[model samples]
Target: MKYLAALVIALAAVPATARPQLAITFDDLPAHGPLPAGTTRLAVAQAVIDALKAARVGEVYGFVNGFLTERAPDLPVLELWRAAGLPVGNHGWSHLRLDDVGAAAATVDLDRNEPLVATLAGKTQWHWFRFPFLAEGNDPAMRLAFRHELATRGYRIAGVTMSFGDYLWNPAYARCVAKGDTAAIARLETSYLADAAETATAARTDARSAYGRDTPYVLLMHIGAFDARMLPRLLAQYRRDGFAFTTLAKAESDPVYAADVDPSLPPAASLRERLQAMGKAPAPRTDYAVELATVCT
Candidate 1:
């Protein structure tokens, strides 16, 4: 009877089709800016943590910028994130763009954040590195060189497969709040949630085209006032779309990570661009900046 039970457990592990999976990751941690009036950074962090807890998310990673920690040491923001049992990775010291700063300078920026994360993470592994502005380098040679540097430092690149310009809304939302424009704020909320759902659909389409199956997806978001407010609903919508919350490690375990070639570009070549380079046509993404401009003005 024990043997039969063990066999049943092993059989259940096999997949007929990839279970729809999504891993949430935040950039510009500790503080991301455009804070609405009357909102403290700690308050923003708590709101985000509460939303994640309510969603019952397993693991959501936050990429930290060391500069922010130095500026806001009084606020135990990183401590709050650690208290929530979430792992934080390096997002570079000043969030400098690799293409703009060059490979050598960028490596130094990463180095600056290492000690900070080491201290904050304690016994936890802090080996993931995300590119600022998603800029790798100006060319393939530079890109590979930086990649080698990361490898030498025992760091894995945190690649993102899903994002819908969620970062663009914070400043606009803050503006609306400052002006007491309730109507514009309402419009921003409605559009932001709808765009997030559409972006998830677009990401899934790219995965199907690229790998003929669903790849565990890494979603890029920011630590911002607006993001904290919307995350709960956004996650609920993802559940309705058949996705299960997952860890960054589990999400990257998909074979696509090992096989997909990094596109030859300087910086900010999104998943859609990468898919297009591989000869797959992905759906168009909504222009968040343009949409925000309408309400912001």
Candidate 2:
């Protein structure tokens, strides 16, 4: 009977499809913005890359600082990344936030990042651009304007519909557990997972609303402190939820993704600033304590 049970488990592991059908994309790697003032950006980024490798996460869009390119030319982080078979996408030069700037400035930001990504990844075109806060800018006409710039540059501007909400002020919240503060740590863990769940659900809904089909999501997460801790559990959770992780190059290959665009001359400064203004939607509640107070024990 035990042998029969083991055989059943083995059979279940086989692919149900000749080719896997689900796809997911990662945006904003190296998570933090330009190495917080007095730290080694290179070392930090390398650690993050190592974590990504360990997690077995296939591909993600990277927005690297030009400084890293200048200082760590031999690292082959980009080459290794591409060799791992993931397309490199531009996050922006200097990793500047667009909301602080305008269209003309936006163009400059885009130019710097794309070219830098090109320099590092050996790809002439950047497949995706994820804004710092997902906060590109709020003027009604500005959205179209930014898209036009992106189109000209042969780039797809990723609008993140879901996120784990790590950027708002992580570490303090996420590390509460390992630090042995049960209340803070417990809430942090729950919040981290719950935030993703909420984001995924919203993305699914938005995809249905916008595309009239449940469009797979482009999840925006930084390769940061909390994310490193959260990845293993998060990945397992997603797999159980049946979502598949995919490279940016692969994601861009789909027609549903609208990947075709001309590689126009390097974008202008105005456009780059506007690009920085792109911000993400507000996060949903991770109020696990209130929601599951009864069983949290």
**Candidate 1 CA-lDDT value:** 0.80
lDDT of 1 by residue, 232-276 (tens): 888888888888989888776654553122222123345566678
Candidate models: Cα lDDT each: 0.80, 0.53
lDDT of 2 by residue, 1-297 (tens): 554354335434433332222344444543443233233434444555666677677666665544345555334555655565555677666566666676667778778666557765674445667665666566646655666787776676554445556554244543343355667656667777877777676655544443344443556666455555566777777777667766555543433343222223222222123234443333234544343333222
TM per model? Answer: 0.88, 0.64
Error of 1 at 253 (Å): 1.0
RMSD in order of candidates:
7.0, 12.4
